[model samples]
Target: MPRPAEAALLSTSLIPTDNSTYEALPLVDSESLQALITHEALNASALELFAIANASVKEYGHPTRVIGSGGHYKTLGWIEKQLKNMSDYYTYEKQEFKALNGMVFNHSLSVNGVKVLDEKPFQLTPAAHVYWADLVVIDNLGCEDIDYAPLNASLSTNTVALIKRGECPFGNKSSLAGKWGASAALIYDPESDEIITGTLGTPTNTTVGTLGISKTLAESLIAQKNAGVPLKINMFIAAYVGFIKTKNIIATTIHGDQDNIVALGAHSDSVEAGPGINDDGSGTISLLNVAAQLTNFKINNAVRFAWWAAEEEGLLGSNFYAYNLTALENSKIRLFMDYDMMASPNFEYQVYNGSNELNPPGSEELKQLYIDYYESKGLPWVLIPFDGRSDYVGFIETGIPAGGIAAGAEGKNSQNGEVLDKCYHALCDDVTNLNWDAFLTNTQLIAHSVATYANSLEGFPLREPPKVASSADVPYKFNLHGNFYIM
Candidate 1:
């Protein structure tokens, strides 16, 4: 192998004004680079990541890493605690932003005065309290005013609309209830027996607080109505809606070249459905573990490791950081690499093709590095498009050459036609959700790439002069298959 440059360590939450100390980066010798990349460290960290993502699974029955929840805060605290040990070589900072979040604190319901324990609360809606409300089953999705015509009973403030989930956005359902003067709405999944959990997208001016119920609950209530029974129901939903403060955790190495930089990031937040271990816990933990091990050696370019928040809500945290960067600050960043879902249970080795029109010149080079690394190891790899599916989008759109890697998630593996991660975005995405081999190999690749870049930016293209950062302005939302999109 031709001798490569020395590797750098991760650092920097925000770039400072006038980082004019641009100097030459020295290559890290091959031996030092090899020393920084180790199997033992990656394996050890994998064990810890599984435990953390699954930490509350047995006790609470789901992950605590969902944003705005107490558990999510604790998980972030745990990361900070880990970084404390490496205080001697690195520093960390936080990026705070206003994020619309919801927490379903408590929910309860009763049928004919008998309490029903099976229920789930809707997010981003206000609290609901009703007593002996008239139960009216909206026959069709309340998307249009004509749909509510089938509700024979005259609507009143005490009306509770029990609607099925389908065809329209949940926000539309809740808003329609308001138009009908229904004080509260209960949505249920007609197909699945599983209790529904979701957000109303954004804060709705409508006073119709929404909650989700299982098919059984809806069926039981509907059956009672069919039998000419006047069903009096009582419901309570203790919830919080509107904006909450959450932050991105950024760390930088005080050891490497500060001006010429390499950045790697992964989101730290999980969806309300589960811990998101394989979806992104794999990425988050890998960066943390690598950042810890990186302190042992020094390199040419400075490396910045960011644990982004609200990526599940449309890459908000990462975009905020990228979009705000001044042209001068953007020039210092040689490459920005993103790693997400590196350990999908049903796996494939995939790298961003970086073919987006706006991606700076070095994108192909970044993709080639991963291609070359896997090839050298006699491993198979595939190319994925720079589809703006993850955190790398903002930087790449702003004229930065960005590339990322993912084992796979939701996307199918052509080799066997298996879903790359069946547990993706589900509660099952916990301790057992990862492909250990993929996890280990990808992380090792991160260490190798970081080390090489830190040692020298030799074969990489010069940073494109920074332009105004931009991304799709559409709302970020969760699709039916549990994937997020800019649609």
Candidate 2:
């Protein structure tokens, strides 16, 4: 990392002067921007900017930032609360958190529509493991899983073996059944009527779809067969994992027009991979710097600075905010600007190519604004696709004009690529992974855009206000998924 004094001096010296081509406002002064990034570097380590973050988790067991886990949300909440306490000029709104609880497996067993087993929330089978088959009780008791001899060649093709959960692990039983050509395996609790959930632990060459049924259900099926009553049963299983309680920290200036808002966002949560300091801490810190500095001046249009949650999980936080907005609320958003990886170690300034076909109206003009700013500063920049891969996806899909910048990620790390960010999403993506020079320059660009739009949206387009659906019209209550990589 660069020395704080040097970084501050270098940052301050590059503050762009007002040009005749575009009218600029001093919403954030040069001195404050320098101080903010300097403060940023000084406080980096204390921020716990690394993977296996929580000492408590490490002391107790392995440290991993699993989505919706205690360590993950707790760290994020603390950071947002600290930022919330930083200023009084901006009003804060913490979006309600949502978490993706364990999957609710819906399954059933029906004998010619007699409904032998009713559909209910069951345990999650392994992902991509779905099946329907006739039940076959291999009452081998202590040796059902190990003794495949009980399941002979005469068994039906749709066979689903029923075994007691005792002698061996769940994976062993499922493996045995799968080897015998059984379509699925039903593992039941030996002592109670309660259904038990189990995992296959890891991938295996032959692992069948597995479910847990109660002792009562297993016995009843056994009795029917003992009574010489021929039974034909059906089974169904499915699983989904998403939407946990995570928040978006939104702080808007109280001095500007709420009707014409200039929104700036950076995702707060990091991936399960690492603390994501350069991948996003750089962007988050940049926004915080600008937000803190902007308190010194007022604006004509509202500047809403947002630190979105669950961005690592597919832009869910931003998507939830945009999806729930009414038409009037959508129209109030003049534009949205996103800041993702602005300080990649091996960096290249990437401006979103809003001139492309993916984005809605007004994106090209926003793209041009960035192009002009970089050109005026004599900086080298390249255009990246506007492919709805970032938080801007939600805003653009809803007709809110959006633009932003990025410093390359994993995909842009090769000889043929414009730039290479080798530390993209790994544990190495810490504070040291950021190039301070690129960090300061991109942050200044963000400050310029924020100030320009907050002061006035003079050159931007004016079209019919956005048409957002009513609350009842949206199919899902929230949009949640995770896997969009940094550009």
Best by TM-score: 1
Please, what is the TM-score per model?
0.70, 0.61
Candidate 1, 1-487: lDDT as tens digits: 1111221123433333332332233345544544564556655665665566566554446675667765567667778888777676667877677677766667788878999887766656788899998888897767777766644455555778888887666777888877767888888888766676555665557747888888998998899889989988898988776677788887877667778889989888887667777768888878887787676665667888888887776577787777767687778888899998888888999988874343678888888889999999899999986667788876876677888788987668979988788886677887678788898888888877787787788868887677673333322111331122311
lDDT tens per residue, model 2, 1-487: 1112211101011222433312243454443444444545524532564442453244224332334555556656555555555444566777665644333234565654576552222222443333345567765652454466556643567777777766555666777777877776777876756454433323245666666667887788788867977666566655544445556777776667888888999877665445567767777777877776676665778889888876665566787777666787788888889999888877877898885344556778889888987898798888976766678877876777788998887555444654466655554566567787888888877878787887788878764467453434432122311232332
**What TM-score does candidate 2 get on C-alpha atoms?**
0.61
Task: List candidate 1 segments past 4 Å from native.
Answer: 1-40, 46-61, 105-201, 204-238, 469-483
- lDDT (Cα) of model 1: 0.73
Task: Go through the candidates in order and give the clash count of each.
Answer: 14, 11
The candidate maximizing lDDT is 1
